[model samples]
Structures are given as structure tokens and as C-alpha cells.
Target: MKVGLIGFGKTGKAVATAILDNNELCLEWVLRKRTLLEHRSVPEFLGIQSDEPGLIYSSLTTSMEELLDKHPVDAIIDFSSDQGIYTYGEIAAKRGITIISAVSHYGEQEREFLKELAKQTVVFWSPNITLGVNYLLIASKFLKKIAPWVDIQIVEEHFREKAGVSGTAIKIAKVLDLEESDINSVRAGGIEGRHEVIFGFPYQTVRLIHESISREAFGNGVIFVAQNLAGKEKGLYNFESLLLPYFYN
Candidate 1:
């Protein structure tokens, strides 16, 4: 399947490389800022060579307009801006292109729009795409029951430039009926990513933690979703839905 990548950041580059590792997936186009495209191909920024002989710079683009019938793709795996979701989501719905977005942080109205778009095309939205984090999310459901009276708090740390709470932490808080105040975001030096779910009682605490060793973990999860995204019905999906086939029927 040909994929139109939406970002060229750390996760984006990692995912692009990981997708290329699969024999079935290849990059058709990448949406980057025009400023970044001033001189060289995104591959130069990413430091990876394209498998196609002459398609390196030709495939890099600054607009989704490049994703046309002349250069179509089966699906689009996006890990770009929160704004990119609406931009590509609308076009993909009309064109019947499947979208798997790893971005969170959209307005309520924007989310409503995406939900409507889902009825037109398949849309998978997840904050964090790591299998380990999904496992933690799955555990939250059971953990909620096991300790309904316990207090829930999410503490996460990311690189200094990352603002606000980790989307994974926010999702976990919501599932466990915790407030935003219970979620803490710490910005520090180049920590890959770390999430800790703390369940506290009178005198004890249980911390369920998942620390990413590198960006490759998230990239692996993106490839897994992309590989499985084919032929899915038009609707909204999450990480749990992606895992449903294996965990259930």
C-alpha cells in the first residue's frame, strides 16, 4: 500500500522508515512546510534514502493536493500536526482514503467534524500508538473495577519542547474517571517518553509505568496499524479497536 505521510518530525521520520521496512508499504508523498521544502527533499532532513530510484525529491510535497488520482494511495498514516487531521480528514473523506491519525488535541467541534467524516471514510485516532501503552489502557478498564475507591493520577514526562499533558496520560485519566488536575505533565531533557499511572490509597500506591526506550516503539505501532488498516469499514477507530481482533473475536 502506498502511504502519504503527514509529518517529518522524529516520530514521522521513524514511522516513514518503519513503513518502508515493510514490503507492502511505500511512501507516495509527504506533507511538509513550504519553508522546509525551500531547497532539499524531506528525505534529506530525515536522512533516509527512498527505495525508488528517482522518486526521492519528487515525492516530497507541501500540500495534500499532491495526493491525487494520478498519485493515489490506499491509506494515509498521519503523525503530524493536530491541524493536519482536519486538513487531510476532509479531503480523505471525499476521496475515500483511509486515515490513521496519531495526533490528538483537536477542538470539540473539530472532533465532531472528524466523527462525521468517519462516516464517509475510515478514521483511526489514537494519542499514543505504542503496544505497551495500549496494553496499559486495556489494563485501565480492569484496574478501575479492582480499585474503584482508589485515587487515580497520571504523571508523564516528555522532551522539554512538548507542551501540555501527554495524550496517553489524558486518555488514561478519562477512562479511570480522573480530572485534568490529576494529570501532571513534566517537560525535561530529551526523555523519549514515560507514562505512570498511580493508584493511591490510605498508605499505599501502585504505579503502572511504561517508559519508551526510543521513538522506534511508537514507529513500530504505527506500522502495525497501517498494515492492519486495509479494508476496514468507514467509521472511527481507536487503539483498542485495532487490538480487538486479537484480544477477542
Candidate 2:
């Protein structure tokens, strides 16, 4: 797959590494807000130095216009903020490119925008891309159907400087038909991520927890979704739908 990356943060670098390790995946180019000097390359932005033969050292550009015009890619994976993905989505839609957005904390407007974007090109929006968490969303639904009397609460922990409650917590809450108040958030200790769903009952309690060992979990998700989404039809898809087999099998 010829893939363009839209961010160069921690998770972005992890995904890039995964792509570098995969023979079928190619890192075509990366788009960022700031341009680096001639002394640096895309790897500098990703904080990775390429050592493997045949690995692609992609070019870096600040202009999305130039990229869309010149460097055509099979799909673009974005790990940036919501606004960056928002603008990129508009252009990607017009160019008929697939976009995998993992931007967190989307508002009503962003949600509406993605819906329209999907009409133009295939788009997968995921706040948390871990396979296990996607399974949790489905599990929450089954648990509710089997035990409606059980009260469920969510607790999500992230790094201390993390902003707002995690979208994973919100997604899980939505799956269980619970309000935001039912979620507990902890932002501390430079943790990657962890989520626990507790089912409370008078007679018994059940806890389902998923703790990310590292950001590689998300990189794995990127590969999984990218492989499945290539050349697919235009549609707004999420993690739950991608992992629907977990519920059946």
C-alpha cells in the first residue's frame, strides 16, 4: 500500500515503523504543519532513523495542496489533532483518497463533516484503534442485553497531561447506553492507555479490562484497518463494525 502519514507524533512514528517493517506497505510521504530544513528528512519528524535496505525515506511537506496534486497515495493515516484531520478530510474527499483518522475528541461538527466526507471517499474514524477495545464495545452491548439489571461504569487512565476524557471511555459508555458521568478518567504517569468496564450487580460483579502494553497496539490496528480498507467503497466506518466478527465467533 502506498500510504501517506499526516502526523509525526509518538503513535505516528510507531505506525511508520510498522510500515517500514512490512514488505507490502510503503511510506510514500508525510504531511506536517512545519517544514524541516534540508538537513532533515521525514524520519526526523517521526523521530526514527531508517536502517533497513529497501526501506523508503519519505519526503516531508507542509503543503497538503502540493501533496494531493503530486504524490498520490492509496490511503492516508492521520494521528494528528481534530482540526488537521478535518481539513485533510475535505481535500482527501475531493481527491477520492481513503483516510484513516484516529483523531480523538471530535465534536458534533466534526462528526457531521466525516459523514459527508465518507460520501466522497472511504473514511474510517476511530478515537481508539486498539482491537481489544473495539471488542469491548461489542462486549458491552452483549453484557447489557444479557444482564440489563447490571450497572456498568467505565474508568480510563492516560498520561498526566492528557486532555479531556478519553474518546475510548466515551465510546464504551455510548455502547452501554450510559451517560458521560458514569465514566471515570485518570490522567497521570505517562501511561499509554488502559480501560476497565465494571459490571455491578447485587449478587456478582464482572470486570473487563484492556491495558495497552504500548502504542504498538494502535500501530497494529492501523495495519489491520489499512489492509481491510484498501480500494473499499466510500463509507463512514468505525472500530466496532470492523471487529463485528468477535461478537459472532
Candidate 3:
């Protein structure tokens, strides 16, 4: 499948590299905020040997409509900011392009915008797009269903530079019907990302933990979503809904 990437920051570069390495996915172009390294081959910049025209474009220089008109893609994997969707969502939806966004947070306005976009095309959004983290969430939810009396606590650890609580932790809390204040946030030195759900039972304690060793986990997640979302009807999808089928069979 042909894929366009939004955002070329540290995480974006990792995701682009993962796409370039995958034989089944083509990295079409990447849109970033700055003009630095504009129009450069993504593979060349990353020191990968591939012929796919993984070009880099600056949002300032190239309009989203111009880019989509010139080079249409089957899907767009966004690791950009929450506001990034305003730039390309409607244009891509009009053409029926799939959108997979991993933006960490979105306000009510963004959520409503995504709902409208879903009416036109397939849209999948996740705060934590790493497969393992999502799996942990699913498993935790399952455990909660079976044992409603268990005491569950969410703890999220991230790099010290990150401000506020982890969005993923908040998502977990929301899913489990816990308050935001119940989440425990730990900031440490250079930790990629870690989330643990502690389940305290009468007899023993169980823990489900997902540690993101690197940003490439996000790439793996979008690829998984893109492959599965290929022929689905227009709708908004969350990662857990897509994963639930796997647990059954």
C-alpha cells in the first residue's frame, strides 16, 4: 500500500524508516513544519538503500491539496500534532484516503472534526499507537470485565521532559472508568515510555505492563492498522476494536 506520512520529528523519522523498510508499504512523501531538508529523498536522508520516492516536503512551501493532487496515497499515517489533521483531513477524506493518526491528545473540536471525516473515509486514532501498549489496555479491560471487584491502578512513566500526565494513562483511566486523578505519573531520565496496570485481587496481585523500547513501535502499530483497515467501510476505529478479533481466534 502507498502511504503518506505527516510530521518528520524524531518519532516521525522512526515511523518513516519502518515504512521504508517494509516491502509491502511504500513511503510516498512526508510533510513537516519546517523547510529544512525539503524535497530530499527520505531513504537517502535516513541512509537506507531504496528506490521509493520518499520525498520530504515542508507544510509552509507545499499545500496539502497540492500534494494530494500530485501524489495520492492509499493511506496516511500521521504522527503529527493534534492540529495537523486540520491541514489534510478533509482533502484526504474527499478522495477516500485512509487516515491513521497517533496524535497524543485531541480536544472536543478535533474529536468532532474526526467524526465528520469518518463519515467520508476510514479513520483510526490512538493516543498510544504502540501495539504492546494497546494490547495491555485491551487485556486490562478484559480483566476488569471478568473481575469487576479487583482494584486496578494505572501508572505511566515517561521521559522527564514530558509535562503533565501521560495521555495514554488518561486514556486507560477513561476506558476503565477511573478518574484522571487516579492515574500515577512518573517522570524519569530518558525512559522511552512505560505503562503498567496493577490489579489487586484478594489472593494476589497481577500486573500488565507495556514498555516502549523505542519509537519504532508506533510504526509497527500504524502498519498493522493500515493493513487491516484496507477494505473496511467508512467509520472511526480505535486500536482495541481492531485487536479484539485477534483475541477470539
Candidate 4:
């Protein structure tokens, strides 16, 4: 299986490492805003062999057609921002490539692009790919039934350098039908990650916590999704749906 990557940030690099570790998939190309990093052979550095950095390993094209024209990718995994994701989704839909978007849910226009894409190709999108977090999504639903009276509140912590609030926390909140405003964020010093959803009532608080000992935990799951998405159909899919059997079994 051959895959294309969008963005070359921490998450992107992490996913690249995981893909290199996998024998099943080959990274076809990476699309970024800038040129390839110094000393990293666009292809060999990414564990592939190709000459055109833009066409092969990392294409610095604003136009999607140029990237698609060069290499017909089987699937694309994007770790880019929302705007970048919107552009990539449009291209993937037009080119009929399966896309696994790691970015969170896009707005109306982006959804429209995805809807159009669904008519022709398969698109798998998720905000958080960490298997543990997806498991928590399930546990949250079950716990709501089991502990009927407990009130749930979520607290998340991330590295200071990380942007925005916790997308994972927002996702879990949405799964539980809670408002995004209800989720709290703690941006602080060198902590990698932390999430604790507390179910409490008048007398007690039961906490369900998932702390990211390292970003690698989530990165591993993203790679797993990329590998699993190979040769699949075109449609919008979620991580929890992918893990349904594990939770049910």
C-alpha cells in the first residue's frame, strides 16, 4: 500500500516513523507549504526513492492538481490545519483518493466538500486517533448508563507549545452530547498530555483519566489508521467505529 502525507509537523513526523516501521505501506509523497528539510532526501529520508521533492516526497505546491498529477496515491493522511485539510479534502475528492484526516471536524464548507467527495471516494476522518481515547469514548457512554446520577466534567492538559484547546477533549465531549464550552483546558509547562473526565455527584467523584505519557501513544494509533485505510472505500469514518468490535468483544 502506498500513502501520501500532508504536513510535516511533530504528528506528521511521528506518523512517518510509524509507517517506516510498518512493512505493509509505503509513503508515496508528502505535501507541505515549504521545501523539504535540509539534508533529508525527500524520498530516502521518508523511506522511499524519488527525485522531485514536490512530485515525490514533499511537494511545495498550493495547487492540489500538481501534486495529484505527479503521483496517484492510494490514500492520504493529513495532519495539517483546518484550512489545509479543506484544500486536501477537495483534491482527494476530485482525484478519488482515500483520505484519512487527523484534523478535527471542519465547518459547513469543508463538510460540503466531504459530502461531495463521499459521492465518489472514501474518506476516513477523525479528530483523535489514539486508541485509548477512543476506548474512553466508549467507556463514557457505558458509564453514563451504569452510573446514572454522576455528573461528568472533563479536564485536559497539553504541552505549552501545542496550539488550541484539546481537540480530544472536545471530541469526547461531543460524543457524550456535552457542549464544547463545558470542557476545560490547561495549557502549561512541559507536560505531554493529560485528560480526566470526572463523574461526580453530591457525595463522590469518579474519575476516568487518560494521560498521554508521550505523544507516541496517539502517533501509534494514527499510523494504525493509515495502514487500515488502505484499499478501503470512500466514505466518512470515525475511529470509534473502527474500534467498535474491540469494545463489544
Highest TM-score model number:
3
In model 1, the clashing pairs are none
Off by over 4 Å in 4: 36-63, 201-204, 230-232
Model 3, C-alpha of 172: deviation from truth (Å): 0.7
Range of the 10 consecutive residues with the lowest summed lDDT in candidate 4: 49-58
| Tens-digit per-residue lDDT, 11-33, candidate 4 | 77777666656666666667777
Top candidate (lDDT)? 3
lDDT of 1 by residue, 140-246 (tens): 76777987888888899999998777888888888888888998889999988898988887798788899999777877887788777777888998888878678
**lDDT, residue 181, candidate 1:** 90
Compared with the true structure, model 3 gives a TM-score of: 0.98
Q: Write down the TM-score of every candidate.
A: 0.86, 0.87, 0.98, 0.84
Give the Å error, residue 102, model 1. 1.1
- For model 1, the stretches where C-alpha displacement exceeds 4 angstroms are 38-63, 201-205
Candidate 3's C-alpha runs over 4 A off are: none
Residue 228 in model 4: shift from native, Å? 3.7
Taking all chains together, the TM-score of candidate 2 against the true structure is: 0.87
Cand. 1 Cα-lDDT: 0.75
RMSD of each: 2.9, 3.1, 0.8, 3.4
Question: What is the alpha-carbon lDDT of model 2 when measured against the actual structure?
Answer: 0.78
In the range 13-73, model 2's lDDT, one tens digit per residue, is 7877776666677777766555433224555544666543222222352356766666678
